[model samples]
Target: MNDTTATLDAPTADDALTRPFPGASPYDTYVHASLLNSLQQPLTEAPDEMGFLVTTQVMELWFTLIVHEWRTARVAFAKDDLDAALDALTRSRRALTALSGAWAPIAALTPARFNGFRAAFGRASGFQSAMYRHMEFLLGDKNAALLHGHSGDRAVHEALGETYREPSLYDEVLAFLHRQGRPVPAHVLDRDVTLPYRADPGVVETWRQIYTGPQHHPHLTLGELLTDIAELVTRWRSEHVMVVRRAMGAKPGSAGSSGLAWLQRRAARPVFPELWEVRGAC
Candidate 1:
């Protein structure tokens, strides 16, 4: 037989590769991809709406992954497991980068294009994203009013309340540093966990010691990794502000926020404030 004929006549291995599953494919079952794909039911036929909806949904999933990783890191820090905590923080940093990248699809929407479907999703603003709030809470930006906003949803409220009650990831980090013989102040260490973490002079001193120590110290490496994560988060927030400006300049947000102004103010708040402060001190 000719080589071409033989190749065509033979049952190729590709057949098995393409074989269908009995019901849902293994990939679908494991990833719940069917359910995820089913969620993008845009409320309007405007072309830009799907991109906007899908981008927001994608960010929500990223937020979920980031929160999971941060929680893992927080637990690791609590156990004084530096390696595990660093691994988790590294994963979360990657997720934040991806979250920031997810804005590309909707980032350049013209105000007219956005206005087409913006009114349809009335009062359904990004401000109401519970998972994003969880991320903020984890970053030590606790807000009682924001947490209370989810009170109508008992399951969400209860879950978020626990995060509200618990020490943030940064808090655990300070406690871990204190255990490692750094002079994290007792008052700062024992401060109320539910309140927003302000930049404490003592915490700045603690980080300053780490930053100014031997150049190759593990603690300094940890500080830099955390700084990377903080910068990525800030970049994401700044990109969010730019996207809002492009889509709808200065318009009030659907959830009653002052839109661009409110987001600009929020983005101004630094994550890991002492870490940033220590750089200048060093």
Candidate 2:
């Protein structure tokens, strides 16, 4: 090759990717990695505490992304934008998978090792995570008591209150289907959005029709996407149970929850219940 060609092909010191920024790196500025690194202040010198703190913080970040995607999907459904809705749901499923995998760091901590750092944090439980609560609310698991718990934090209460009052992602999906001529029950359509959603027989029948109809139906694709998200969510909960079982076992949760039992109950509750119910008929 010619020298000119060789020079052009070779990476230069002045290349934008290799050049240093005038202040903080562009990536650091955009992502705020410095700010994030500063947040993990483990309270004890216990070796496991840092890992536990980092893992929990990482999970919180994944929760934020999942909530953002769910909200996007909800809006897309409201606008009758199936493709956009599916894209967002697909993103969230991947996030949930990663969220589940995040348990790896502390998954094997024995009870003794866990207790070494557990007492240091004192009542700061994963159950108190507002972001995770937002995910639950988005999935139609509205609990008045949970929302009320955040009442002392005006900003958090107001934000969660908006999600509580608005139709959940599932609610929007059913409305979108109704707009497409599906027979979603009028009672379900008109139900108070603030209340916890109950699985309606009519909704199950609607899903059954979709499952039994054309295999390539767009609505069927939507159903599968939702099912994937639901299963991943359940898997994440089950992994949480596993981690807690290994780390602390049957003990009370950091924030006074029933610990393993509470997590098991949550894992047992199916997401998008009608979709799961339709499987039997199909």
Candidate 3:
């Protein structure tokens, strides 16, 4: 090649990708990596504390993403946009999978290792996580008391209260199904959105129909996607319980919860209960 052609083809030190910016890198600006990295201020020198703190923070980000996707799916369902709804649910399933995997770092902390830093951050339990509560509310586990727990923070309380008042993701799914000629109960369709969702026999039968119908049906695909999401959430909670058991062994949680026992009970409650219930009928 000629010298000019060679110069055009060759790499240069001034390439935009290699050029330094005057301030923070473009990636850091977009992702706020500096802010995120700066937030992990471990209260103690204990090595395990850093991993614990980071893992918890990582889960929070995942919770935020999952909640966002669930809300998107809820709106799409309301508009009878099945493709968009399914896409959002699929994204949320991936997020939930990552959230479940986040336990790895602190998953095996011995009681002694955990104790080394546990007391340093007293009364800051995982139970106090507002984002996690948002995820629960989106899953139809509305609890007014839990929403009230963040009353001290007006912004957080208001945001959570709105989610608390709105129809849950599953509620929208049922409404969509009803619009599509499924026999979702009138009472279920008209129930107070603020209240916790109870598994209705009618709803179970609706899902049962979907489950027992043609295997390639779009509605059946939706049911299976929801089931996958539920199973991932259950697995995440179960893993959390096991991690707490291994790390602290039935000790009280940092946020005044019963810790392992509380988590175990919470894990037992299935997400999208009707979807799971229909499986047995099928």
Candidate maximizing TM-score: 1
- Cα lDDT computed for each candidate against the true fold: 0.94, 0.93, 0.93
Over 188-219, each residue of candidate 3 has an lDDT whose tens digit, in order, gives: 99999999999999999998888888999999
Per-model TM-score, in order, reads: 0.96, 0.94, 0.95
TM-score of candidate 3 to 2 decimals: 0.95
Cα lDDT for residue 221, model 2? 94
Better of 1 and 3 by TM-score: 1
lDDT of 1 by residue, 111-144 (tens): 9999999999988989899999999999999999
Give stretches of model 1 more than 4 Å off.
1-11
Q: Candidate 2: TM-score?
A: 0.94
Write the residue-wise lDDT of candidate 2 on 192-268 in tens digits.
Answer: 99888888999999999999999999999999999999899988888888988988889988888898999999899
For model 2, the stretches where C-alpha displacement exceeds 4 angstroms are 1-20
Q: Rank all candidate structures by their TM-score, best first, as comma-separated numbers.
A: 1, 3, 2
Shift in Å, residue 279, candidate 1: 1.4
- Which model is ahead, 2 or 3, in terms of lDDT? 3
